[model samples]
Target: MDQVKTSIENGVLTVTVPKVEVKKPDVKPIQITGKPTLSTNFEEVTWAKLKSAICAIFLKQPDSCDLEKLYQAVSDLCIYKMAGNLYQRIEMECEAHISTALQSLVGQSPYLVVFLSLVERCWQDLCDQILMIQGISLYLDRTYVKQTANVRSLWDMGLQLFH
Candidate 1:
């Protein structure tokens, strides 16, 4: 025979049941939005798409950028830019092209934090290239710029020369 007892307290019902332990299956966290959804083999995504996506995310959210947005941006860019050739062997070469473009942009403006953030969002290979370009830019600035010149001094010179 089964026996059961219940009591009501503070507008609630309480009941005692047999103790049982249940194990739940381990589940992987699903990242639905703002994440790169790669193909099964992981070879379908091109580096160009990834880099552009990362850059777009940086442009969109200049202050609060994350890996998920970076990944999504890359995925979306890949789909739009290399739509027809994404599945082709040529996709493998996109990395080189992307790296060169990013390096060129960073070289043009090393002081911009956006460039650095974009590099951080990219793959290690692209990041290395960007860093190398940035280093060269910094070297040039340190070597060529006169350290003794101050903003006030420059203003005074401007007044003398122009005014």
Candidate 2:
């Protein structure tokens, strides 16, 4: 159901990438990839394994990865780490994701559109990969982030990592 249409008029090429169309009162779930569901067995998911998967994904490897599995692994850790009073580890990992993303944006031509696009894309990727795990840290978000008027929400916290 996904498609790309292209038209060439004169010297310019117009490419159209179709986005998901929604119907009234029946919103479809966000489909991040073709293989959308990850097995929720987190017992074997170590930080090293998760880190490797993340590096592969960010490095744009051609291998098809199950992001749902990665997210579930992350959620499992959040339940244990975030509540076990090891917030620093989670913060560090988030920062690393942003840093690697920013590094990838280097060496591109200095176009405003490209700059803004990369920044937004960076944030979007973080949100897409992590926000779905919100329920894992929903209490932390509601208590630690939302309770304070000036603090950013869990979603914003990821965005700020890029900034």
lDDT of 1 by residue, 1-163 (tens): 3457688999899997756678999999986787556565443444444445434432343324444543444344344543233322222333345645556555545666877665555545444433432232232223222333432222232223222
In model 2, which residue pairs have backbone atoms overlapping below 3 Å? 38-69
The predictions' CA RMSDs to the true structure, in order, are 18.5, 21.0
Task: Single out the weakest 10-residue window by summed lDDT for candidate 2.
Answer: 81-90
Candidate 2 per-residue lDDT, tens place, 9-75, comes to 9989999998988777976888676754434644344455655654554455533446565555555
- TM-scores for candidates 1 onward, in order: 0.19, 0.44
Residue 37 miss distance in model 2 (angstroms): 33
Error of 1 at 161 (Å): 36
TM-score of candidate 1 against the unseen true structure = 0.19
Write down the RMSD of candidate 2 (Cα, Å): 21.0
Candidate 1 — which residues are off by over 4 angstroms?
Answer: 4-41, 44-46, 54-66, 69-163
